[model samples]
Target: MKDNFSGHSDSYSKFRPGYRSELISYLVSLTKRQQCAWDCGTGNGQLAVKLAAYFDEVYATDLSENQLRNATPKNNIQYRTEQAEKTSFDASQFDLITVAQAIHWFDFDAFYAEVRRTLREDGVLAIVGYALLQVDESTDKVIQKLYSDIVGPYWDPERKYIEDLYKTIPFPFHEEKTPVFHDEYQWTLEQLMGYLETWSAVKHYMRDRGENPITLISETLKQSWEGFDTKTVTFPIMLRVGRL
Candidate 1:
């Protein structure tokens, strides 16, 4: 897996949106047991903290120690710095395995091998993520230009999986149908900028140019965002659940 967010782990933990309760409840309902869960590539423990409430134990692992350091603490949750493709977990340990917004970075074959080895017979593997955020048409137009024109070439190849909505990703399991879900937030323009700053492509652009690209679109975004102290931002959730 790639370690893209470690440098701005603090910003990640603060600005990234959490999974909605409806989505969490739905995942919990699919499990036959709530004994334990493994959240792989669990950046900042966002999904791990949620699983903690439903399971006896939740083990969240990430390749970035900086991200793990800022993870939210829960009594039943254990955060570790580990790769997604391999782990020290025992066989048939987890009742459910979850990868939230991080599976695109994994070596799928290797990760699936570990999933098959560690997941119980009835365990479900849930891969979840969200599409690009949507706001008003005017703001969205400016944002789209920034995404496609400004930093388009900077995005990693793995981003194609997300753009395809995970439909084309390798999944060798019995797939389950899932309901449509979304994450909605009331955020200010500054909050939106903070979230955009967390994008890996933006980080890559800054690295190569020695300048933050967000500055280029700031004034336009401010003008587009005028008249609203807080705007409704919606992220359409994409989920793929399966069993080995």
Candidate 2:
């Protein structure tokens, strides 16, 4: 199924967590000098702008035009509307490449080939994704249940693909798992519901069922958020970085 991200671009940019500055700094230092880089599936140009800040140029590509339009970065970052698997970058032209939270939605075989083609010898390839907020057992119990019972089913397809991460992908990347990072957010019940509705699962479910997931998720989260403070929430994040 086509990933429907256009509708949630605004929320994603606002709410979705970004890679750490430490990680970004590491990405810049990988080549040991400024060089050309590509930020594939660069949703809203978050990492692309960072890549451009150090690299000579950054080719930031995404399938979502609205995300490109919404990004405002101060760097030599060129935005393109292209799918990750079918980008038209010159072969062996990049010194570094990164994908943030988007590898799950790609044709891995084609993407890996593209990475191999575009990256210079010993070029860095960083493919990373983070844990979802309120999607864990250690956090609020209600939040965990909501994710498992409500969002889990719809997200299973993509989640299953990501399970093998660096193991299944045959790219020449050195893999390292980051120490889990945590984030805290202050949200009202309504705000929490809004976040839930922005999830791919909820959006896709809404499309298929022809019902307001907003209303449903809101009601459900409201009933569930009683024990926990809706205003204060903590989210633990786990990230796996595959670097070449």
Candidate 2 off by > 4 Å:
135-139, 162-191, 217-244
Q: Model 1 segments beyond 4 Å from truth?
A: none
What lDDT score goes with residue 49 in model 2? 75
In candidate 2, how many Å is residue 9 off?
Answer: 2.0
Instruction: Using TM-score, give the best candidate's number.
Output: 1
Kindly list the per-residue Cα lDDT of model 1 for residues 1-244, writing each as its tens digit: 8889999999999999989899999999999999999999999999999999999999999999999999989999999988888899999999999999999999999999999999999999999999899998999998998899999999999999999998988999999999999999999999999999999999999999999999999999999998999999999898999998
How far does residue 206 in candidate 2 sit from its true spot (Å)? 0.9
Displacement of residue 182 (Cα, Å) in model 2 is 4.4
Task: Provide the lowest-lDDT 10-residue window in model 2.
Answer: 131-140
